[model samples]
Target chain A: MINWSAFVVVVVVALVAAGVLVTLFSTALRVGDGDAPWRRPVSVGLYVVCGLVVAFGLYLIIPALHAG
Target chain B: MLVVALVIALALFFDFTNGFHDTANAMATPIATGALKPRVAVAIAAVLNLVGAFLSTEVAQTISGGLIREGPGGVQVTPVLILAGLIGAIVWNLVTWLLGLPSSSSHALFGGLIGAVIVGAGIGAIDGGVLVSKILIPAVLAPFTAGLISFIATKIAYSITKKRERDNFKRGQVFTSALVSLAHGTNDAQKTMGVITLALIAGGLQKAGTGPELWVIVVCAVAIAVGTYTGGWRIIKTIGRGITDIEPAQGFAAEVATTATILASTHLGFALSTTQVASGSVIGTGVGRKGASVRWKTAGRIALGWLITIPASAAVGALAAFLAGLGLWGIILDVVLAAAAILVIFLRSRRNRVDHRDFHLPQPGAFVRPKKRKKAVAGG
Candidate 1:
C-alpha cells in the first residue's frame, strides 16, 4: 500500500526547505552587495542560516547522523 | 557458477551505466553555467559518489521489495534470469544514451527484471500490486513533485535578486550539486549492490535475505565512481542545454530542488527515479523564469523516452530470457548479441561526438543553440 502520509511529508518538507534556502540566499546576495551599513551584518546572518540548512541536508543524507 | 559470474559482471556494468547516465543529474547545470569546469565537476561528483556509497544501504535492502517472489513459496529466481534482465537494462541504456535522452536507468533495470522473471518463472511470479504502488505511481509523481518545487524556488530566486546578483547563485550551485552527487551515490550504487547480493543468494554462495558483502560494496562503489568520472557527455548535453538554457539562478534552483527531493525520497525509502526528478527540476525552472522559453519539442521527446523506457527494455529482457532459457549456448548467444549491439552503439555515437568542449560551443546540429540547431537540422 502507498504511504500517502509519507508522500505528503516529502512534498511539504521539500517545498518549505527549498523555499527558505533559496529565499535566504537570494536575499543575502540582494542586500549584501548594497552600501548600507546594516546590510553587511544582515547578509552575513542570512548566509549563516543558509549554511545551517545545508548542514541539515547533510544530516539527512548521512545514515548515522540521520538515524541519531 | 559461470552464470552467476556473468550476472555479477553485468550487474556491475549496469551499475557503471547508472553512474554515467546520472552524472548529468548533478553535474550538468554546474557544467552548463560554468560554475565548475566540466572535468572538475565530474571529478567532484565521482569522489562524492564514492563517499556516499558507504553512507548507507537502507535502500539496497528493499531493492527487490516484493517485486519478485523469492522465498520458499516464491518462484525460483535463477542466475540466467538476472543475466537476461541485466542485458535488457544495459541495451536500453546504451540505446537511450546514443539518442541523447535522459530516461530512468532504475526503471530500465526494474523493467528488465520484471520481464525476465515473468518469462523465466511465470506471470504469477510478479506482485502486480507492488509494481503499481511502488514503481508506476512513483514514476508519475517524481517529476511533478520535483518540477513544482523547482518552479516555486526558481521564481523566488529570480524575484529576490537583481540581474547582476542573479549570477552569484553560481557559487551556491557548487554545494547543491555536490549534495545531489552524494545523494545519487547513496541511492544508485546501492541498487547494484542489492542485485549482486541477490545473485549471491540465488547462486547459494551466500545466505538468503542478507546484505551485500564488503567486497561487493567496495567494487560497486568503485565501478560507479569510475563511471561517474567518465561522464555521459551526450546525455549531459541534453539535460544541460537541450531542454532549456540554464542561468546560474535557475541552475541553483533546479539543483536545490533536486537535492531536496532526492534526499527526502531516500530517507523515506521512496524508490523514485533520480533522472526523472532532476529533469523535472530543470523544466520547472524553465517555466518559472519570466520570458524563458522551454523547448517543448525536446521536453516532449524526453517525456516520450520515459514512457517507452520500461516497455522497450521489458521486451528486450523478455527476448533475452527466452534465449537464455535454452541452456548454456543460449546464455552465450545472448552475451554475444549484447556485446555486438553495445559495440555498434558506441561506434555510432562517435559519428556525432559530444564532449566537454561542446558545453561552450554549439555543434552545428547540436541542441546547444536553438537558432543554429534549427538550420543544422534542416540541412541534415
Candidate 2:
C-alpha cells in the first residue's frame, strides 16, 4: 500500500517540478521588461493551468481510496 | 493484442512528436549559426534519428519492464492509461512551447508512465532503483556534463574561429550541424521505439519484457523523422534565443556539447532528457561567451517543471487507474478529460502559429539585457 502511494507521490512531485520549471524559465526570460506585451497573463495562465491539473487530480484520485 | 498495436502506434506518435518538438534542441543552434540550412539540417537529423531508433532498445526495455510492474493480468497496460499519459505530456509540452520554455518531453514520458503505472498497477509496481539510477541520475548529470563541455567547447570554438570571416564560420557550422542531427537521431528517436516495444510486451503480443521488434524499429524511426521535419518552432525560439543570445560560435559550441552528451547517454540506456541537456548547454555556452545574461529565473522555472513531471503524471495516472478500474463511468470521464485537454492545446496553438520561420529571422536581440557576472557563471 505504501509503495503504491509512494510511486504516485513521486510522479506527482515530478509533475510539480515540470510546472515550476516553466514558471522559472518564463520568469527568467521576462526579466526587466516591466511592460512587455502579453507575458504576465500568459504566465498566470500557465500557473492556473498547472494548478487546475493538480487540484483536479487530487479531487478525483483521493476519493477513490475511500470509496473503493 | 490489438491494444498492443495501438499502444505501439501511440508510442511511435510520441516519438514522432518528440522528434519534431525536440528538433530545436538538436538543430536550433546550428540553424541559428547558419551552419546547416533549416530544411537540409532537418533531413539529416531525420535520417539519423531513424538510424538511432534501431541502435538500441535497452532504455525501452527498462521502461516497459523495469519502471512499471504489470499485474497478474499478464503485463497489461490499458490503452487508456497510455493515452491519458500522452495527454498529460502533450498538454505540458504545448503549454511550455507557447511560453518558449525548453521543458523535457523524455521526462514527461517517463513521468507519464510512472503516473499511469502507479494508478494502474499500484506503487509497488515501480522499480525505484531503475527510476533513480536510470532516469534521475542521468537527468542530473547529463546537463551538468553538457554545460561543462559546452563551456570548454565555446572557449575553443571562439579561439579557433576567432578571426575567420563571418560567412566562413557560418559554413563550418553547417557540417557540425549535420553531425549533431545524426547524433540526435541516434539519441532521441530510439525512445519511442522503446515505448512501443514495452507496449507490445505488456499486451502479450511478444515475449514479456523483450527488445522491440524490427517493424517497431522502422516505423518509430519514420514517425520521428517526419516529426523532426515539421519543426517545433516554439522550442527553437525558446531554446535558441530565450536562454541567451547565441552567436554562430556559441551555436556551434552548444550543438557539439548537446550531441556528445546525448549520444553517450543513449548508448548507456540512461534515458536522460535531451531538452534539459540542450537547454543547459545553450545557457552554458551563453555564459562562456562574453557579456551574456544567464536568465536564472527562467532556469528556475524549467527546474521546477522537471521536478513536477513525474509526480503530476503519477497522480493523474493513479486517478486514471482508479477510474479506469471503476468501469464505464471512469472510461467516460477519462475520454472527456482527454478530449478537453486536446481541445485546449489545439485552440492555444492556433492563436500564434510557431513555425520554422521563427528560426530563420531572429528578433534582433528582442530579449537581450545586462549580465550579472556570478549568475552568468552559474548558468555556465
Candidate 3:
C-alpha cells in the first residue's frame, strides 16, 4: 500500500536540492563579501545559476509550460 | 441544490482557514528574520497563492482518489455528509489556530471526511489501503523528511557564510519564501477546488471524475488569497518566534527545504501537509545551528497537535455526521453551532491579539533569543 519508492525520491531530491541551493548561495555570499574584482563577477555567476534552478522549479510547476 | 451550495461555501471557508493557517509556513521565517516585513510578506504570499492556484490541479485529482465509494455498488455520499465533514475540519482548524499550533489542515479535512463517511456509510465504504498509502504515511514522514533536509542545509548555510554576510541570505529569503507561497497556492487551493468539485459531482451538478470548473478554481484561489493577506499572525508568531530564534541563514535554509519538499510531494501526488514540512524545516534549523536553543516544550506541543489532529477532527466529524443525519433542522443546528464556535474563537483571539508588529527585527550581529514570555507582549 505504501509508495515507498516515491517517498524515497522525495527525500533524496529535497536533500540534494536544498543542500545545493543553500551551499551555492552561501558560497556566493562568502566569496562576494570582500570587494575583489574577480569575486564580484564569480559570485554574480553563481547567483545566476541559483536563479536558473528557481526557473527550473517554475517550469516544473506550470503544467502548460511542459509537455506530458 | 441548497445543500450543494452550502457545502461549496463551507469548502471555500475551509480553504480560507487553510490560507491563514499556513501563511506561517512560507512567510513566517521571512517575517521573523525581517527579510520581508510581516505585511509585505503576507501580501506577496497572497498574490503568489492566487497565481499558483491556476498553475496546476494534479494534486486536486488525487484528493479523494478512492477514499470513499460513491458510485454503483457503493453508498452515495450526501452533500450533508460533506457539510458535516467541512464543519469538523473548520472547527479543528480554528481551535488549533487559537492555540497558535501549526497543525495539518489537509489531515483535518481528510479526517473529517473519513469520519463523516464512516458514520454515513459503513466501514466498507472507506478504502483503508488508499488512506494508508496516501494520507497516513505522508503525514508521518513529511515533517521528518523536511526536517532532515533543512538540518543539512542549515549546517552548510552557516558554515560558508560569515555573520556580516547574513544579509545576503536575508535578501535570498524573499525569493525562496515566495517560491514556497507559490507552491502552497498550487497545492493547498487545489484541495478546496477538489472538495468543491467532489460536492458538485456528488450533487449531480457536474459529471463524475471531472476536474473542478473554472469558477470553482477562481473562487477557491480568491478566498485563499484574501485569507493569506489577512494573515494568521498568532500562528506566525508561534512558528517564527516560538520554534527557535531564526536568523537569515537558517530562515533561507528552512524556506528552501520547504519549497523543494512541497513541490516534490505535489509532483508525486503525495497528500503531504505543508504545515508539517514547514514546521519540521524550522525545527531542523534549530537543531542544526550550534548554540541555538529549541523550545522543546513548544515543539512537543506542535508534535502533539499533529498526532491528534486526525483523530480529534474525526471525532467531531462523527458527531457532526450523526447530528446532520437527523434532517434539515440538524443540519441547521450544526451550522449554528459552527458559526457560534467561529465567532467565539475570533473573539478569544483578540484577547491575546497577535499581528505584524509583534515580530520585532533583530539587530544584525546581535543574536537575541526570543524571550519565552508567559503573556504575549503586544501593542493594541
What's the ranking of the predictions by lDDT, best on top?
Answer: 1, 3, 2
The best candidate in terms of DockQ: 3
RMSD of each: 6.4, 16.2, 5.5
Model 1, stretches more than 4 Å misplaced? Answer: B59-63, B361-380
**DockQ ranking from best candidate downward:** 3, 1, 2
Q: Give the TM-score of candidate 3.
A: 0.93
Instruction: Encode model 3's per-residue lDDT on B280-323: one tens digit a residue.
Output: 99999999999898898999999999988988888888888999
Winner by DockQ between candidate 3 and candidate 2 = 3
The lowest-lDDT stretch of 10 consecutive residues in candidate 1 chain B is B363-372
Q: Candidate 2, B249: how far from true, in Å?
A: 1.3
Model 3's C-alpha root-mean-square deviation from the true structure amounts to 5.5
- Best prediction by lDDT: 1
Give the per-residue lDDT of model 2 (tens digit) for B1-380.
54455456556667766777778877777767656666777777777666655554334445444566655643456666775566555556655666666667767776776777677766776778877866676667656766776776676655433232222334335644555565566556666766666566656676975666778777877898898887787777667666777776577566656655554444333444678778878877887877777777777776777777667655655565566667667766765675586578768888998776656654464222234334447644
lDDT, candidate 2, A2-68, per-residue tens: 2334333433343243323223322323332235757556645654663454344333222232345
lDDT per prediction?
0.88, 0.62, 0.87
